[model samples]
Target chain A: MKSLTKNDLTLLVAVAFLTLFAPFILNPFPEGSAMAQFNAGYPDLMQRFVIFGIFAIGFNILFGLTGYLSFGHAAFLGVGSYAAVWMFKLLSMNVIPAIILSVIVAGLFSLLIGFVSLRRSGIYFSILTLAFAQMMFALAYSVLTPITGGETGLQLALDDPRILGSSQTPEGNIPVPGLFGMEMRDSFDLELGSWVFTFNIGYYFCALVLIASFYLAIRIFRSPFGMMLRAVKSNQQRMNYTGLNTRPYTLAAFVISGMYAGLAGGLMASMDPLAGAERMQWTASGEVVLMTILGGAGTLIGPVLGAGFIKYFENIFSKINATILHEWFAFLPDGLEDFIVAILYPFIGKGWHLTLGILFMMVVIFLPGGLVEGGQRIRSWLQARKSKNGRPNGTTEPAE
Target chain B: MDAIILQILNGLDKGSAYALIALGLTLIFGTLGVVNFAHGALFMIGAFCAVTLSRILTLSHTVIDETKTDFLGNPLKVDVPYVHDIFGIAAGNAIIDWAVPLAILFAIPVMILVGVVMERGLIKHFYKRPHADQILVTFGLAIVLQEVIKYFYGANPIPTPAPAAFKGSFDFGAAIGFDPNLIIYPYWRIIYFLFATLIIGGVFAFLQFTTFGMVVRAGMADRETVGLLGINIDKRFTIMFGIAAAVAGLAGVMYTPINSPNYHMGMDFLVLSFVVVVVGGMGSLPGAVLAGFLLGVLESFASMREVIDIIPGINQIIIYLVAIIILLTRPRGLMGRKGVMED
Candidate 1:
């Protein structure tokens, strides 16, 4: 029995291996060293990487396959987070029930939204999704305060009744979210010589979910349903002329992608039992879009790569400040160093969004196919050079 | 009846803003055939133009006055505006007080340059690209412009008050023989309404009467054919983009007193304005203006205590709800041409 197509299987194994050893891989610098500031082995950032990777993967399935840009996709993720947090409050601290409920709730929510938004294609669909998301965000931030917790956000409280688990631990504190026996916050640090690799249960859990999400995405990409979605993207009118009802296919894809987003949201809340309406904001939606496009939207591994790239940069860029800038350029004369720091100040730390905005524009303007396409072009070019020396290159297919 | 009248007046004020922004958005879309997400940024820049002119007019230098002594028996140092030094104190003081109105003069040329550069440097390349690409690029541009504004002017809203002469509220109801002070409104808001009407009328008149406007209207109807007729329609569209920018900027400049200008204010208005544009009919100028006022009124009505008591959060979602309904029921929009963006 064949598992995956050779290239896909190779991709899956590589991803699995990378995720398993991520603590080591992400922590390249030695402890107490200047470069250690760049290390991202901590649980919070690592969980974010995989969680966002899952989001981008899900986003890619809809956008990359069908070319339908849902500008409000983050609404589903926000809904999923709210659901999961509510589950943690009402049912149990166990992430299992929360994850399942979040997925189901997100699926139903997306179904309702998709049914309405899918009426029109192109920019109308984008605007519809945007309006719905904005509407939800406003409601969640205001009148839905009883359910959504308003501006302060929904946080797990000490009084929350976890029917399956005790309301509070023996120490008289709120029970932390956990798998039946293991707490999400549990961490283990491994030291080898001067290097420190920190690992957390939450990060591993998220990584495992990401691997599964990635695998499922690959399966979907190789499926006939995905072909129909691609066909929808290329020519919906032609597909309609052929008597195909494209709505159901597109709707189904939208729902599935929404469920994937919900899954990511659930995982996020599981790691930290809180949810904010801000997650549903248009900027959050735009970030996922940027990730998918940056990584190469249509390519199978592209979204994951894009997700990692963005989250990692966001972390790194936000950590840089004037002091760090001055440290980096300390060799320059005082005037030059001050000038350079002033020039660079607005693109780092709290101003990282500006950098993101600029990068997003550049990517859309010059590299519409994303980083994956750029890589493919380079590889093909290298092969062409080899073919000049009499070794022919394999014909390449555009990322799908 | 008084309460209802008050809400309607509020709605008209809100509608004036919505109409102005949506007018510019529709103008750009109608002429260039590009969905510009950065058009709101132009509106935002216009408000900042007012802020900037105020800042510039008040540029001052320290002068030691011999007549006025400090507690230390030293001559008092006075900060005197450069404008006062240039054109005696009274004239400079007058110019500074009227900075917001003067910004209209400054913003027109600046906004036109911005619009032309955006059209030529960025939006021109996107004419042939997919709508999604156009949206994405322009959205990115919007963020960049917003961030650039935030960097220079901090994140807080800058209060650019209307001139002192128009500072107080005007009781218009008494003039109309209603109970005194029953329908009082700000002098500035009344000015804004008249100003919006003037701008809207100017745009319509420009489009209706001028050779340039005629060429643009013809281009919008059939670009290839217009080109075939040997008119440089692209150049006119670029100028149309400039005019649209000026309109949005002027609206922004006038709007600063009504709602203090902030960097993100453009985005806040942009989403609703897009809804207004869509509901008005995608490419129809009249549709956009009609839809803008209609939605504004509807939104105001929804926010009324009576309406909110029944629908809870209806006001929050009313514009979007209306837009969704209109989009579904009338895909061609209230004033949309049949073939334009139907697919």
Candidate 2:
């Protein structure tokens, strides 16, 4: 704990601050305001931001540090969710056991997958993991219907035998997940003037876990183990010639990331109580990968930012309908407004994926280091301008 | 025995599609040394090309039908296709029916254009990048391409039927001395198999016999040497990219009859095709084809009633399971060459 550097501590504190105040921070617009549609302070989206943040952070530990991209990480996430839900159904409504079981199960699953997949490097590794995830998805969606609940998804049943707790609440509803006596869905709303801030028990609980995960990730980044991972990424052949077996290190990273995904999935189930097979699909895996890369893969805070950015935009963009577009563009002449709306329609609302895709490609092409690199570039450019004004062409390298 | 024969026959058309896509993937990987993930999008685009052509052929204007009245007693209006005015009713209807086949001609040029532009515009910049970057960039491009398709064509699957002549099933069991009606195979599937063979044979011949192909093959072996010999290998490789894209597009175009063309069909086939490539050997063209068909047949056999009764979900994981085993044991795949993507 004492090994934490000042920068790491500052970064941790910043993230902790951001997550704690997310309800207020996310809901900048007041209730019924014209811009209120853009507010993402709701419980569902906020829960997702932190949960997916955890997923991406863990992913970065493997991909960013070790440079091993696993396209099957979602399989672990799905397994985690299923395990948690099963724990809820079979044993109790208490979430601690479920979360622990999910992490452990996911870790084991990832270890098995990583052991085989780590045998190959590069694209082969990616494909192997993808194949495994897809196989898991296919099975969960079909033959494992009894266990997974097939396309309808695994949901808490009223008839479920709660070995440790009552099957149903006092109100006759299927008992919701909780920590001790506090239910996950319970929330407190703070109304200041016209604004409403939802302080949810689930979001706060998830936030604490995310902070712990982020702290652990930061520690990992600064540790010798992380340096070894970076070594594996830079050149595995050199590491081998240096007599260090790189496979174990990679497998460990894969498993750790898988556990993180599992943790996120567990949290997701704890909040929602429904585990769906769709969460394990290749596209879901791709979403995490996109989040990690889009945030800046190797950077500590990047994945969290990326996750928040994507989830927030996804919510905001989906809310932008034609009616909203008309309202926004009311100032323009009719024909021109229609023309602009037509031009912009496909990139917003249901077409947010198109925008995301374009943005992803642009980031990959121009800013390989992701938003982190963009920030660094802008800072450097500003510094370069300052130096140029003072020193008169004394800057050595060109600002890129 | 008939069931086995039927499954194998059923496997052939899908195997053909896999082989075609894998074949194109190998060509791009071998020639340009780029992992083209958007190759599946090219296939989807090809299927949509057939859909587009069919839609264009059937494009119509409303004409009044006084003989048929609506419930409200207004004259019923019937759509009269522009093709009917140009080529007469029977001919136009036939053209529309054969749109899936005629799309081969229509798609070839369009696909080649798309391929060339993709290579020249996007892939050209990625030549010196790492394989991961290539994959990521191509994947992003794929998403963009797929979403664009979804925008133009709604999310539903558009069924593009094969020509009426090839509509019915052929009694393969009866012809081959098995029980009659035991092995009824779709004519279009047989035609698809034949067409796939023709394309595969044509590709092999093009690479084997032609001077341009020879240079391209040499470039695949050693680009520096070919360039040193004053042959413009890059140009040939670019053309090879176009060829690969066209091949995938043609596969998609032909596959419309087997399965309806949806925006996501490419992504569905892509993961399997990638497995085919890895199992076949990354850069080995024949390996891709061999593995494609082998896995396809294997998949069918696994899906058999007896097999599923025993293994439960063997059919779902068979290809991936085989891929994992083969990848672990044979590392370079079935017929992979050394020094190709080994790093």
Candidate 3:
């Protein structure tokens, strides 16, 4: 491995600082505050933020680098979840073995799928991956019911033989996922004045893995192999003419990314310990793509941001109902309030997907570079205005 | 032998749908060079058109009847459709009864308009963009359309029944000089099959015999050359998109009686149709139709009780399995031309 550049070190530091202080940053509202509904500092959402961040980061390595959009990525994620659940069923409640097994299983699955799917590129590649995922989903839903537990998904059984540890905890209940001794669900709540912040063990564990994965991604982005992958993306015909075998490089990238997805899936199971066939669905795969693109595909931090952004809206925005809309519009006259509620009703709660779709379309049409580019545009616009007013801000351009 | 024929018939019925959707998909791809993820949504809208028309025909107002009494001994309140007053009871009843077929007429204009608006409003801008961008944008559009439908109609599947005349199954065994009760098929499925055939034939004939289609075909072959001939090909391509949308919509409209109409039905068919298009060779009309029927029949065969006993869950994944094999071995699909999207 090459030594980290100054910019890379700065990114590493920034990511560490941000993730370390995420609880405080995410929870801006005070306790018992009216705006508390907007708070995203909870462990479940935070864990999802990092877990999906890892998934998107892995996806970027394949899609952002090689330009091969595998719509079957969720199959690997699903495979990983099933593997992890099986690990829990057979071995112990410890997440280490489960995560390890997940990465291995997903890697093998992607290798098989990619070896065949990569024979074609462009839309064909996308369709092939989609078909494979759908096949896996069908299997998980029906034929592989014993392994995947069918529709209800794979769950940890109370009577299963655990050679490494007891099937049930000492309390005669199902064991929670843990790191050796520390429970994943364990949290330390700190209260100062009117505000309370929770530091969760699971969130931190996921954050650590995400940071490591992000760092590894940065290295890959700057590596010679990464350059080769980019070359394949830019002009495969030229690469072929140059006598370079692009298949192995692409296959390797696919496997690596699949493992990352598996890692994310394993972490998800560690947090929740359930794996459903829905995890392997094409929609789940599309969600990861949306995350990568929305955050700004081909960029390092963009996928993470996109993942966080979507998860936030999916969880928080979907919680808003008619009553909340009515309350927000209560200051208006009765007729106007009713009108406003009616207008706002469809874009919230169950209509969150509609909002997401519109947002995705707008992003694709106007901001191809994604949210990252949107951020850059805003910053540059602000800088231009500041310069025009004869006061220059010393802030340099942000890292890609 | 009869059982084999029955499965083949089943396959043909299934294939008709696949062929229709794939044909439309190929038309759009050939003319516009856009992979429309929203094509299925167009079909769904077409089906909903039938539902909408039926709802309109059945639009009723409450009428209080002094001669009739309710269970509680109060004056009876009866709902009477406005169509009954306008067209008379028998004609109104007929109209409502044949709403699914009548939806074809309603869907054609609506689908074309929707297609035109979709092309003008969104897809036109994406002509110069990469296929990925096109896919993403259209996928977004599809989700939006589906969600909008869900918002209005709710998430449940709405059963749009065929006319009373087509309710019974045809005894194919007796028709084929076999045992009387050996083989049977639903009348609606047969109608759906025939309707699909008509649409496919019509689309092919229009493209083959018409000047507009000739120009469109020429433009599809080489857009720059067609433009150099001082022709406005873009307008015709826009029309082609509308026609494609209509084809898909018509397919969806007729499909309602077979499977019931739901918001997500379009999405369910979308992936399969895309596979059909790819397997048929992306921009080839005949390829799309052939592959659609081929896969449809294969799917039916895979779903046979004997086949399922041999390979559990083969029914659910047979199409995708066939697609992967064909794609890996013959990258251009069954009838894919040499240069169409091979890159």
The candidate that wins on DockQ is: 3
Model 3, residue pairs in steric clash: none
Tens-digit per-residue lDDT, A232-310, candidate 1 = 9999999999998999999999999999999999999999999999999987998899999989988988898889889
lDDT of 1 by residue, B124-189 (tens): 999999988999899999999999999999999999999999999888788777899898989998
Runs off by more than 4 Å, candidate 3: A391-400, B71-74
Q: Which candidate would rank higher by lDDT, 1 or 3? A: 3
> Taking the tens digit of each residue's C-alpha lDDT, what string does model 2 give over A181-214?
9999999999999999999999999999999999
Sorted by lDDT (best first), the order is: 2, 3, 1
lDDT of 2: 0.94
Ranking of candidates on DockQ, top first: 3, 2, 1
TM-score of chain A of each: 0.95, 0.97, 0.95
> What would the TM-scores of all predictions be?
0.97, 0.98, 0.97
* Residue ranges of candidate 2 with Cα displaced over 4 Å: A390-400, B64-76
Q: Please list the residue runs of candidate 1 whose C-alpha ends up more than 4 Å from where it truly belongs after superposition.
A: A333-335, A386-400
Candidate 2 structure quality by residue, lDDT tens digits, B1-343: 8999999988888899999999999999999999998989999999999999999988999999999999999999999999999999998888888898999999999999999999999999999988889999999999999999999998999878889899999999999898889999999999999999999999999999999888888999999999999888888898999999999999999999989999999999998999999999999999999998999899989999999999999999999999999989998999999989886
**Residue-level error in angstroms, candidate 3, position B178:** 1.2
